[model samples]
Target: MTDPADRGAFIWYELITDDVAAARTFYRNVVGWEIAAEGQPLPTGGTYRMIARSDGGNAGGVLDMSAEMTAAGARPGWIGYVHHSDVDAAVKAVIDAGGAVHMPPMDMPGVGRMAMVADPQGATFYVMAPTPPEGDPDARSDVFDYAKAQHMRWNELWTTDPDAAVSLYRDLFGWTQEGAMPMGPMGDYKFIQHGGDGIGAIAKAQPGGEGSRWQYFAGVDDIDRACRAVTDSGGTLLGEPQQIPGGEYSAYAHDPSGATIGLVGPRKET
Candidate 1:
């Protein structure tokens, strides 16, 4: 269960893709996650695979996009789930704040209620009121831990309207805007803090870049090795890994299913 004090923190992530088998293989090789062979049955008649870290804690989930979902305009992509106390109220707040609801609030038996919403700029993510497991009310999710490998270390939002997107999220999640780093003509990379931890940054999207979207980075043990695995596993690296401010490295890529993914880690020379 998510702590009440951590309402706005990203507690979960999901990859909605058409090719689950390929995505499973790709991420397993690239991020070293131990994806389950079989998953728990979903109420909607499909299995939802849970991603597990090396410590046996859940990292996130993978949902196989059904034909109906595809025809209804669903695409292969990753979406982060923010913890909310009231998903229905959150949905209303999003709509009232000029955002739109992609998926109306719905309950999944033991999973609690959730809704998919987009920022005013059309960057989509989920807001969930998660139901704690039996006898585990204090269980906190560590899927977004920065120092843990195979966990999400960063959540980068590149939007057509960075200010509006930032404002909408801030209003909805209680996140505060913090210091920023200048990114030349692209604009400032403004950091976002949730519960006093740097969760991610908001940046203006480059011209011709994929429109407003969130790109999550999972921590890897070796940036160089992960880059090699991406290409070796039928994925495409956007560019060479680049060093970041903290003496670490980051890289972006598209998986075999064309879902954008990011990786951050130490640059290990082979």
Candidate 2:
């Protein structure tokens, strides 16, 4: 709804899941979020489950990864939304910047412009500049209230070479590398501010552990409760949750299928 061009995370996120209802329940119970039906079907079929506050405002959506999409090898995860003034130009920029377009620009009968793309390192995400809603964007402060137990607070990309990734995005979307974000052994982090303000991040990938991948941060009010819940829910604690300098705490974990995700919560802000 706001200017995607003025940029800073204009669009937040969307979850891609095989079982929409399961995700709905997990989020509702763990994160304290509520979902309302978009009351519309996607081109492939199934409804768009909208996350919102009790008063109703658009936080994001739960994208049902259907059998067809899964059979085609579509993995379930969150697709990051990037702001774009023109979908075609964005797609072209992706190709020109060494990234691949996983899905070309297309129109949603009701939704605005959208496209799917993968970075040179093979991480997948989406870009969408929403169309004007029939009414207006929700004026609620707690847009993410419905899924209070959200496992992802922020999404960060760990790269082997920050310079290469930075160069690619700087060329692709005109994003600027602000400064270094320190994360213990994770090494110096590069914070990317797109369209002058939209914030995303990139870091040197952890050696000998995992390859280049995008990680999402799940928010929790109580870190201990959240960690315990993860194990109880058939999820694996990838590492112990630790308190970051700012009072915020986080750790790595995997869902039932072993998709890596992060658990994050409010911490001291400098």
Candidate 3:
């Protein structure tokens, strides 16, 4: 069974990329992280590089997309896993809630049970009852520290139907809308809380294909400097760094392998 505290928690982040070396470099420079190759071979048949932070806890894993997998439709992007009490029950609930299963529940021996699913609106993610890593029963890669570079500080979701999406998540994960702000054109930006911890925000997507997905903000020391590093590392900013509602600064960008990522930090004064 997954740890009680981890239920509905974003326990892990995975970057499925076509170019592993390029991804390793881009994130290392941009998020101030280091990649250490995992010694064990994955049951799924790929090398997993562990993203290491300053404090030495892992941040995520990088899986090099094989040509066969890419041809089968694997794209360079981040997929976050929500820890669940039971993978089968989670899959059942997802199907009952009108979502579609991309992969049926499967046990990976060393990795525990996992199933991939897309929400009713089609945003995909994984629900897994993960087997804890060797020594640590509480296996968590995401460390929340907005000031520490290499940590994931914020999570955001832009969906086609905000109200419906919010309802679906509420039913499935027990997340609640803690508060909201009027974004004028963006409608209401709602803060999503799981078990009282405000973890992310959600907004209705603008009229375009880019909306219905999740994006993560990697904490950095300086937003401006991170933007420069993004471009230097073969990534480009979607926009200039702007102040978040609470005064922290952030900017969005596409990584070298085409994965969209964001940088967050306090504004540095001259």
Poorly placed runs, candidate 3 (over 4 Å): 37-45, 135-147
Report the lDDT tens digits of candidate 1 across residue range 1-270: 666687898999998877777887888999998777776766664568999887888889988877677888878889999999889988998889888998899987778889999887888999998888888888777899877689999999999988888888888899989999998899999999998899999999888889888999999999999999999988999999998989999999999999999999998795
Question: What is the per-residue lDDT of model 2 for residues 85-194, given as tens digits with 9 covering 90 to 100?
Answer: 67777788778767898888988755668888877776677766666556666321223222344423465787777778888777656788887767687677777675
* Candidate 3 structure, TM-score to reference: 0.92
**Which candidate, 1 or 3, would have the higher lDDT against the true structure?**
1
Worst lDDT run of 10 residues, candidate 3, spans 37-46
Q: Which residue ranges in model 1 land beyond 4 Å of their true spot? A: none
Cα lDDT computed for each candidate against the true fold: 0.88, 0.65, 0.81
Candidate 3 lDDT, 151-251, residue by residue in tens: 78777888888888888888778888979989998799999987798888889888865858888888898888888889999987898998887788999
lDDT of 3 at 198: 82
- Give the Cα-based TM-score of candidate 2 against the true structure: 0.81
Looking at model 1, which ten-residue stretch has the lowest summed lDDT?
38-47
Q: What's model 1's lDDT at 187?
A: 91
User: How accurate locally is residue 153 in candidate 1, as Cα lDDT from 0 to 100?
Assistant: 97
Candidate that would win on TM-score: 1
